[model samples]
Target chain A: MAEPTPSLAPARPPTGPRVWNNPRARAIIYQVLVLGGVIGAAAYLIDNTLTNLAERSIRSGFSFIWHEAGFAISEALIDYQPNHSYVRAFIAGLLNTLKVGLLGIVLVTILGIIIGIARLSTNWLVARLASVYVETFRNVPLLLQLYLWYSLLTEMLPGGRDALSLFTAFYLNKSGLMYPVPVYDGIHPFMIVAFLIGCVGAYAWGRYATRRHEATGVPTPRFWPSVGFVLGLPLVVWLIGGAPTAIDVPQMERFRFVGGWHVSIEFIALLLGLVVYTGAFVAETVRAGILSVSRGQTEAALSLGLRRGLVLRLVLLPQALRVIMPPLTSQYLNLMKNSSLAVAIGYPDLVAVANTTLNQTGQAIEAIAVIMAVYLTISLAISGFMNWYNKRVALVER
Target chain B: MINLAERRAASGPVIQMAGVNKWYGEFHVLKNINLEVRSGERVVVCGPSGSGKSTMIRCINRLEEHQKGRIVVDGIELIADLKQIDAVRREIGMVFQHFNLFPHMTVLENLTLAPMWVRNTPRKEAEDAAMAYLERVKIPEQAHKFPGQLSGGQQQRVAIARSLCMKPKIMLFDEPTSALDPEMIKEVLDVMIELAQGGMTMICVTHEMGFARTVADSMVFMDGGEIVEKAPPTEFFKNPKSERTKLFLSQILH
Candidate 1:
């Protein structure tokens, strides 16, 4: 390792290794090769698919979406006919999927929180019951649960002729469940306006009460006032606006129910399955979240003379929600995706409609792509909202 | 509740325990303990870990139930009755070794919580009281900061402030300075000394013999689940009676 002359220093000898043998250069070269390989594979696959489609004379584009879908759906939230375009059918299917997903999320969240708290109850029997529920539903296969619920709803219930009537306004049969639909004919706008005004007033009063309590020691009636504003104001406005009072009760005709708010049996089965299955995972997540909080927190709250309920509401829940939310968001996404299982029970959700389109048109690639796109869009939207919520609740640690 | 002057004139003990025994699944933790702390008296309880000093003070507020005992705080006996337990707990303030201040709350919020919720004090009043206590601990500027952002000494002072906001008749400190750094211990100890000078009834479990010398009216020494000796700090340090007390003092003082 002798030093080179000044004149030759610019062209120094290789002290360590050649450029190709250098670790950094080798790593870059390897990464480039991997990237090229992936690109080449994708390009080849795309080319092969195009050539095969051309050979079979099967047009490959989304233009088929505009074609009429000549198939009747059992349950349609919006107006639909066999002559309706595939796009319309897709929209209807997407709406149904969203309906189940939204409702399941709400129901599962409530059930999960209750069961989670019950699992930690001081009462032995309550705790044991919650444990049994979580274990039972969580262990069973979700698809099997859907099948069982569907059978229970359709096979066990009587036909529409002998519908099980409840309070003479609601009826349940093998076809579906139905209940009275409220008709506000001409006074709808006034009632809605009154309800909105009441909501704003109630919110203002709540803020004022909180501020007054902070300034003085007097506690205001918060809960009852909120209830009154939300319910009473709307009722009063309906009466003042000449309450329509033309409720349409479910009427059982020869073979089916007519003129009422009806929920299809397929929708009910899917909802029950999604709620029961996803709820178990959510319960476990809730339990884990609560348990992650140290015992010292509870003892500290209790020692401060906070009652058990207040301790739970203030100290326990705020902390546990931070832990519960991130995982709970994933569970919600899982529920939304699992709603696709409705296809197995003849429910006209997004996936079920897509499958029908694929079978009729022999457009496997197009149909699969649409299905993936819909699911992907939904999942991303859910994740975006969840991430925002997660950021708000995360602990501000130094 | 009697006025402070009348209650002081009565000379009744703020805390009393007789034949107090506790067990953790047949493992006897506290045995045949008898103690009394009068109003405005500062008692220091010191022993090695597991000697039941912390457990005994915890029993004062019913944080730990004594299986066999009549533990009374401010005339409210410790029992399974929720009302009695709540009453006793309301009148007592507690500090922990880890400075178990709520991490989610600011120093001011931690101090004001019990005053507002338990005492039904107005939020404005609770905040003012919290600020006063924070100033007394000499860290009023840290009120808006969360516990996690504060140093160990500062957090401990905030815990002290939180306890004081309850306007408690008695304060219990479970190794308040044990978890602090060597340099930070004096800061917390200084706050404790100020509290003692203010005539707060305090039962502290600490190994800081210097703090004991400065603020303790009486020192209670325990070993093997029994109080080996109890006497005024002057007499206990100079004229320890039991061999266990002598041994404990020798080891800890060194």
Candidate 2:
């Protein structure tokens, strides 16, 4: 068989210039054009703002940051006076913000997890109650909730003289909560040290028990013994220190209570608002995350003879966390930013303090820039940590 | 390889189901099913789709709660109490059609998890036994790789090894080879056949009739939420007693 005679095709047409036809070259040109446009626009805006400031004789710089802040802040986490510089005032505001933000994060997480699991409870009443809480809190606007709490605390509570008393040491009224604080004593430091040692000892015992269980195939009781090491050791130290009992309790002095530690109503209202609002969203996130795991995984774990708690810890949580981390990070960031609404209720958070500074110094651009930068930095840090955690818990799929 | 007399003399029935009935919402999934599995006997359950065969076996380990009747395994009854269910599950190992291996863990970790946590076995001992099971399944080298990295056949075998690592007294296979490719079915079935030869009591739900004829002491045909016919493999295939079983056999065997 003679292989059919070879056939030739017609010659190809010439192509256009490579620069315009090439995808990579075109992409580079488009990126350069966009960058140039952005830089030009930014330069123009900067020059225009500076010229306008000069024309109006407005002093524009960060020099105002060094000058003394003359206004009084309602709440300060750190030592602050009207004579303090703007830098110190801002530091106090930042500290206050951090206090509420950290506390709110912890409280909301615990509340959210409880509500999320409760929503999945077998009891109809528990699930219905959880659903009601989530719906009621998340549907109302956060600012409105803050206002509601502020009004409730200020208008409904009795005067400080008629404050509601708990054991005669803790008092609650329009002035917020007043409680007893332990007086500084030499033995206090020893007790704290003993507690720290007790914590470390309990942790060590847990580790040793796990090691023993692995080595011998015999499990040991962990809960009660660890509790003993943690609480018993501290009690022993307290007894050795002669058990000093000096406390500074708040007492009514004319119109207001004096002594002890007092939390302002503004701070309480803001914290309650942030926690209650963010908790509802966090609960939904948790519920969705747990539901994302297939039912087959749970059945498989149960078939392996693992009890309910062990199955949740060993199989369910590890899988659910991968789905939970990203959205949970968003909720944390939201809570932190939502705390800025503290200004509406007159709480001294970062944005509230910066607003005061801007009004006093007439440096709108600088004050706003500082506020934006602070929020951006904290938000990035939270997301970075969550990303690392998510990576650790993620599945190894091909 | 027939050691029927020796196995029959080993012990009484290890699994007993009397008047077992189950429902899903208003749908009756299992209806008054009664069965007994003796020690060291291999029984294969075959059925058409939606026949409740899987649900029947699932109730053996209390994965699916039976609305009525009693299922006693290894002397403990399956009940609403978690303790009894856990006790029953410890003695029974089940293989799923989808091979539900923990995807986050490697093959070795998957095999060792139940033994170490549930049985309270030491980590080293559990790992040693896991490796041995992996060797038996002929995938010792794949122990370090995750389930997602393995082929369907290899993953199924790893799952079998995971079950065997616990040294369960009774093994339940629920459509073990149904999800596998035609070329890979024989690999899993070969391991199961070897397990049968070692005189393990097994209840497998599979459509692989050749495997049933080779290893099963009895063949059970279920249809419409009930066991329509059950007999020895030779008699069940050669002479089916019920019309449903005959129709199912004719359709499936072809």
Candidate 3:
């Protein structure tokens, strides 16, 4: 060891010789430099893009979105004239996307949960069938599946006079699936009010039944009463108010059927493809989540004398959902993003309509930005909702 | 119902197993095991690993199906009948090795679950019973806490309290103290000993010979899917009848 320094001199601080040499200071400096580099790179790209747009004499902004879009969408949920603004077309397209995405989420979750449980069934045939379904749908590319469904609906189904008619109100043909629309004359609002009241009454009834069940051992059946609440009240009110609702059956008049609600083949193809494809991955996620809980949980619950159904409802599902929710949120987000593939099947989703706007207006950057912004908003919304749900079901692992 | 109550109150054996055999696929896990546990008797079963000690007790609650056996609990015979299985399970409470408390529920909720759902006890009544049991197990302060928040010993005690809330006639403990830390084992064993002193019929599968000696009315030594020797704890420890029991006792005690 070196000789000790003179005691009179100021004692050297324990840390380091300089601020630059200090670990905490160095870490801050390194992060600042990385942040600067990232900002500089982003600034450069933005500048380059601006300069290129100027050189090409292309106006880049959302101003042109208000211009008229002359192109017509084959299928629209809202009324759209060809003379309507591109903004209107974009709104319709966005609604289409939301419609399909929401429906797909619901259908896929049901299908996935059913298949997931069936795969774990003791019945060999049911398990095998679910396995076969999962393998078949998951292995095929979604785009290819969409194409196949599109062709099948367009080509396989007979056209015109040979249209397959279900009862007198529904028709299936090359055009699309058509179903009867109820045309309400007067007193529609009263019927709607009655329906709403029935729903609230039914909810109160359920709460009362649950309370009664807890107080006594007698369980009140909820299904038939719920059905009556939904359908019976509305029907009763309609009859009392001079039943003004009439079914508008579609009439086959030569080329196409008239006066009915129609779902286009493109919409059908996109929906089927998205739901069936995403459902397989969801099924696997569900299975893994349920399996992650140890078998002892069920044994303990059953041994405590709970019924089989009660054991599953109280013990298995709560634990399983804790493991299921986080990954299930990601699967939902993926499904929403995958809906951008609608362009391949001629479905007028946001991307498809935005592409048309870009081609017509020559405002490529703005169009692309709009599409990105909408997708980002939708993704954030879905994740936000799911995060709340996940927190509610999360284990209290204090 | 009157006859059934009369039979149950006659003070015969609460649990009986005769010529019980079980197999997992092709491997025989339990072989021709015969055992009996009377009312309010504490039977401690000790065995080496894979000796079918847990399996034999599990058969009493029908957690594991015995392929060939005449197992009966509380005057009702165990069979493939779902109704009878549920009835027997309702009367017999079990505690697992890992303290398999429902992690999602609070300690009080876990205790009240079976009482409310199975026994149809009202909420206030179930909660009252649960709090009483929690006090008995000496963890009433942690009644609202989740299982994960408690130590291993505390969770095991909560599990025992949960079982007692059901008012079970017979309790089966499958290695209750096996999963606890060394210091924590004493607390759990203390609770179990208190439970024993209160005249609750209990069949415990464990290696805690000291505990067995303290509370067990009879000690059973099992080896390789069969009971080798069984006697009062003092006699069993002093003079084990079988060579395997002697070897096991030497290895464990030394």
Per candidate, native contacts kept equal: 0.52, 0.69, 0.66
Name the top lDDT candidate. 2
Runs with alpha carbons beyond 4 Å of true place in candidate 3: A1-20, A185-195, A198-232, A242-245, B1-10
Q: Name the regions of candidate 2 deviating beyond 4 angstroms.
A: A1-15, A193-206, A220-236
DockQ of 3: 0.63
lDDT of 2 by residue, B1-254 (tens): 56687768778999999999988999999999999999998999999999999999999998888999989898998888988898888888889999999988888889988998889999899999999999999999998998999999999999899888878999999999999999999999999999999989999999999999999999988988998887999999999999988999999897
Best by TM-score: 2
> Worst lDDT window (10 residues) for model 1 chain A?
A5-14
TM-score of 2: 0.95
Sort the predicted structures by DockQ, highest score first. 2, 3, 1
| Clash count, predicted structure 1 | 0
Cα deviation of A255 in candidate 2 (Å)?
0.6
List, for all models, the DockQ compared with the true complex. Answer: 0.58, 0.68, 0.63
All candidates' TM-scores? 0.90, 0.95, 0.91
Backbone Cα, N, C clashes tallied per candidate: 0, 0, 0
TM-score of chain A of 2: 0.92
Local accuracy by lDDT, each model: 0.88, 0.91, 0.89
Over 4 Å off in model 1, which ranges? Answer: A1-17, A20-31, A188-203, A217-221, A243-245, B1-10, B19-28, B79-84, B120-125, B223-228, B242-247
Docking class of 1: medium
